[model samples]
Target: MIEVKQLTKRYGGTTAVKDLTFTVDPGQVTGFLGPNGSGKSTTLRMILGLHEPTSGTVTVEGRPFRSRPRGLRHVGSLLDAQEVHGGRSAVAHLSALARSNRIPRRRVDEVLERVGLAEVAGRRIGGFSLGMKQRLGIAAALLGDAPVLLFDEPLNGLDPEGVKWVRDLFRGLAAEGRTVFVSSHLMSEMEHTADQLIVIGRGELIAAESLEEFSARGTRQSVMVGTPDTEILRDLLAAEGAAVRADGRLLTVTGLSAARVGEIALVHRVPLHHLSTRSGSLEEAFMELTADSVQYLAGEPR
Candidate 1:
């Protein structure tokens, strides 16, 4: 598990993170979400001990990560896939990390194969595409077989297949009781992959809870109703203080529940063809919750 308590970081007069407290438990994938310039990268660096916190503390598996020898053996992180030496072969790069952490040289080959880079093990990283480089970085993270892994935008340059593979890989690792923390801007991917979420904005914690709970925080719940008497139902629903939008025989309703809509329709003897509730998606929830936290707002397109 990873624990952060009242963590804060400052650079000169600017505060990058403030009093952030959260725990990333094992046996599940936790997503780190925030808008641009929201201090996500800064927080990740602090967690890896790359940046010192002005105050508070961070620990992996009950102790400071910097206090542990062979850090990779405990926490594996991929902060930047492109940070590796471009001239080195994939195998050579993994080999160096393995040797530094006193890991077996053979483990390099295992991780390379696992990440689908064994075929290009001898190729120089400079010649690889962005996606290939991402794979190599993932290989290095797996080199130590660490129980706690942290990834920042691991899906940045991946194809659909690679993305799916990564999703499955994280799930597999969590099933084995490893702590998997992922930081990504892709809400759809997080919706499918993460079991929990840690949301921050402007260096402060917004939410730290299960994915379901966070999603449920969105207030844009609506009911979809299909009826032949679309105009009649629209007027009837409007009378109940519900906003209703009509498209032919279908009506989208807000400020009401599916059961209530059904009741209203039945009471008025309006036959209904279909009725279902539609909850807001993760992206919608994120946008709504982080609206004020966004640093750069674009104006309407011309």
Candidate 2:
């Protein structure tokens, strides 16, 4: 488990992270999410001891990271896949990291194969594709067989297949009782990949909850109905306290179910053409939940 308490960071007069506190539990994939420049990267840097926090503390298990250089054996992280030496082969890089930390040499081959990089073990890092680089990064993170893993945009340059592969890897890790924390800007990816979410905005915590809880209480549902007499149906639905909007050949209605809509069309002598129900999507919920915290909003009225 990773615990952060009252963590804050400042650069001169500007605050980057403010009294942030959250815990990442094991056996679940926790998504660290925020808009651009919202201090998500800064917080991760602090956790890794790359940047000293202006105040507060972060601990893995119960020990400070710096106090325990071997602590990484329990908490593996992949912040940048391209940070490796360009001259080294994939196997060489992992072997060097393990040698430096006194990790066994055999573990290098194990993780390489685990992340599907064993086929390219002899290839130089400079010649590897972005997807291959990502795989190598995962191998490095798993070299110590860590129970807690942190990934920052692991799918950044991956194709559709690579994206799916990373998603499955994360899920598989969490299923094995490991703590998986990932930070990404892609809402679609997070929607399907994460079991829990830790959202931050403007250097403050926005929410820390399950995805189900984040999207559970929606006030409106999207309902689509097709009918030749859309106008008559719209009037009937509106009179029944439902908001109705007509779009081309279909009528969009809220506050009414497909069964009720069919009965309304039948009783009103309007022919029912089609009916479908759409619950709000995770993308919609994310936007609504983080609108105020978005640092940049495009096409704003000037």
Candidate 3:
């Protein structure tokens, strides 16, 4: 488990992270999300002690990360996928880390096979593609066989297949009672991967909740009706206290379900051409939630 309490960091005139607080628990994948320059990387760095916070603290397993005995054995992290030496073979690279940490040399091979990089164990990292490097980074993270894992943008350069592989891998890890904390800018990608989300914007914590709950808060069950008798249907629905928006041939109705909308049309005797419920995409809900606090907002029209 990892806990960040009122964490804050500043760089002279600019604040990189602000009083952020969140807890990552075991047995689930917690997704961290924000736009670029939103201080996501800065927060991760602070958690791992790579960046000293101006205030607040981060702890791993109930104690400060630095003070925890055999801390790396409790937490495995992949902040950068290209941290390995280009000249070194994959096997040799892992071997060096394992030996330095007094980890069994067998773990190197085990994790190499685990990440499906066993065949390329002898290949130099310089010859590997971005996806291959990402896998290698994952292999290194698992080399410790730690209970907690933190990955920042592990899907950045991966192909679709690789993305799914990583997604499944994270779920598998959490299923085995490990704590998986992953960060990414793609909301759609994290939609199914993470059970909970910790969202931040403008260097501050915005919202943290279960994925389903978060989406539900931003939207509700609504139905869209399309018919030629738009004027009549709108009047009927409006009289029933349903919020209606008419956009060309489509009418968006809120505060009513699909079945209710159908019943309303039947009662009013309005000929309905098409009626269906419209569900909001998780990405849309996320964008709307962080719109005001987004750090890199587009310029307004002149």
Number of the top-ranking candidate, with lDDT as the measure: 1
lDDT of 2 at 153: 90
lDDT winner, 2 or 3: 3
The Cα RMSD of model 3 versus the native structure comes to 3.3
User: Model 1 clash tally?
Assistant: 0
* TM match of model 3 to true structure: 0.86
Best-to-worst order by lDDT is 1, 3, 2
Model 2: clashing residue pairs? none
Off by over 4 Å in 1: 229-232, 245-249, 267-269, 300-302
- TM-score order, best first, reads 1, 2, 3
Model 2 residue 104 lDDT score: 93
What would the per-residue lDDT of candidate 2 be over residues 64-122, giving only the tens digit for each residue?
Answer: 77776675587789999999898999999988889877899999989988878888899
Candidate 1 global CA lDDT score: 0.93
Tell how far residue 295 is off in model 1, in angstroms: 1.6
- Regions more than 4 Å wrong, model 3: 68-71, 224-260, 267-278, 299-302
Top TM-score prediction, candidate number: 1
Model 3 agreement with the true structure over 31-80: per-residue lDDT tens digits: 99887788999999988888999999998777776775555577888999
- For model 1, how does the per-residue alpha-carbon lDDT over 102-162 read when each residue is reduced to its tens digit? 9999999899889998899999999999899888888888888999999999998899999
Candidate 1 has its poorest 10 consecutive residues by lDDT at 293-302
Candidate scoring better on lDDT of 1 and 2: 1
